[model samples]
Target chain A: MELRRFTQPSATKPTHTTVSNSEIAKWNILDRPLTRSREELYLSTFSFLFAEAVQYLQTRVQQVSELEEKLNQLGYRVGQRALELLCFREKLNRREIRLVSILGFIRVQLWKFLFKKSADYLKKVTDREDEYYIEEEEPLVNRYISVPKDFGQLNCAAFMAGIIRGALDSAGFTASVSAHYIHREEKSRLAFTVTIFMIRLDESVMNRERKLAG
Target chain B: MSSSRASTWNKLGDAAYAKSEKVSADLVALTYGSFVREIIKDFEEPDQVNKELEKLGYNIGIRLIEDFLAKSGISNCSSFEESAEIISRVAFKMFLGIRATVSNWNSEHNSCSIIFDENPLAEYVELPPEYTHSLFYSNLLCGVIRGALEMVQIIVECEFVKDQLRGDDTNEINIRFKEMLQEQVPWNDEE
Candidate 1:
């Protein structure tokens, strides 16, 4: 194929033209109105990128905890942005006021938007009132990842935990979120693998919830 | 015998290519574009942003080759031309769901162009006026090719020669093979 190279006229040249402030403002993504039912991105791309991110973090961090912390930090930033975006798109006029409500929101709304489906289970810790669990049989982030025997304790779901923490923190609920891998043997095919994200709300947050409820 | 072996490898590559999963192209483009935009915002310099994107792609490429090899069950390429064909036919299709054509072979046959009719990364993207000259929007692709080739012991220089986002006729990535990296053999204890 003959490559056709055309010279653009001076007025149409892309290089020298200055974009005014008005144009920049008009094109600003923040200024755009949030639309419901946005198109979904490719899951494979996300998986590949997440895999690379984990690989990159693995190389940088010496300890398993360090890698988890790094992943969590990365997810925290994403969670913050996702919270804002989800709220805007859903047109929610009020912030989540209760512990259960916010956790429900994360498990349902946030999960739906990010993964196109809700998490498998949301449960309260029997012994600890302040601790809650959001579980998934297969996490989207961990779809392509296979943890080695040495790094058996490492749950890549730490990124998701960070996202939960970031979202909760931004919503005025201070909490520590950690991801744990639970292995179960059952007769059914869906038996073995499960990732549970534990959310531990701070004392102040629990107190505030009690005050609001009472 | 070598031809038969090559055919067997080709069959494996085809099977791998066929078995690879598909995903939404829009998602890939938006996520990648947004990530690049975020990097650009952080660096606040186009050159630095390009370097960073390339570095990221290089990291991805190194790991991606492992996935590719495992999936395709292909161990080696007989020549640089064969590698180029495999990349265009099998690797790009399996990963990106886009087919690239290898063309414009140089006199020495060491250089060629991979032309993309459509680019998943540049979908719905327009370069801002200021970034037209400074940003090589898909520099990551070049880095990926370079990194993957290097892993196979083929040292190649790759660059985005043209982009549709830049009002070019088509998207073309030019690759020039420099040299093959020789494998180092370990010393035997008995020797």
Candidate 2:
């Protein structure tokens, strides 16, 4: 397949016959196959790449929150693309309409795809109808990262939270997602931090859920 | 003899990669795409973005060489030629799950080109027309090779001579030998 290189002025529209065939491309990107899903790579490759991303973002921002926001935005891009590719690959014909199902889809399907395991916990806030949480004892992004004491309240899992928000927002479920770190200190056992992804659905989504249930 | 050695390295690469922990390639691709996009957004020029990406990869490479050494379990290479072969056949395979071809060697065997048709980092990427002329999308790989070689006492200048992202036939990283450092003991070594 060949795409003609256009050299004409922008003001006038040129036909294929008038345009010069200066360059030829061997393969069209659109013609590439999307069905093959067996692509796997070393975890260390990702870990190295991700660590560099964090360090690069660190130099670009001042505050921890700002750094996280940038990381989230980057992850958001990935999540948006991942959602479309995953849906197409899985051949999921039905769009997720309800709020809970979309959240479930993210917790089970997206989580499994990215992390190789379903999220450790998915729970609804007892007092709030629009709030939910997906907790991971150790997020894959945070595996090799140990937050220094000097840097406070910088959860690298903000990238994961952004991923959740991106997937949710693209699926037409508007929500605000944030990552919170919970330090677990067990007696006679080693201490570890858990990452909780807090997802808060929008009022419109709540109304739609209520209408669907009614 | 060299063919047998290449086959052994291929087998070693396969074994090491199979033994290591793995992740979905899509995640890596998306993350890399996002990282490059972020760099492009922050930097005004494509050349600047390319430099930043290379610096990022250099940092990663210096540290990753340690992991690569531990995983591959090979202590030494007899010559720079041997190192290039191991890099294309073993290191690329063990890390990225793809084996690149090393060719176009100089008569002195001090330089070579590593070529690969399939790039995992570029699986779902199509370079924007605006950035294709000046940007080397995979310049990070060049930095990685340079940094890793520096750690092994073989200082080499590496750069992307060809990139499929720029409508090239294949991705090729050209490496030129510069210097070799003398071995030294640690600063705190006891007499």
* Tens digit per residue, CA lDDT, model 1, B1-191: 25575455456655665665544343355446555765676688989888877888887777678778777666776678888877876677666655677889999999999987656676546789889778888888888888888888898888888876666667788999999988666568577
For every model shown, what is its TM-score relative to the native structure? 0.63, 0.90
Where is model 1 more than 4 Å wrong at Cα? A1-43, A88-95, A185-191, B1-56, B62-138, B149-155, B160-191
Candidate 2's displacement at residue B14, Å, is 0.7
Clash count of each predicted structure: 2, 0
* C-alpha positional error of residue B33 in candidate 1 after TM-score superposition, expressed in Å: 8.3
Question: Model 2, residue B184: what's the lDDT?
Answer: 83
- Pick the lDDT winner: 2
Which residue window of length 10 is worst by lDDT in model 1 chain A? A32-41
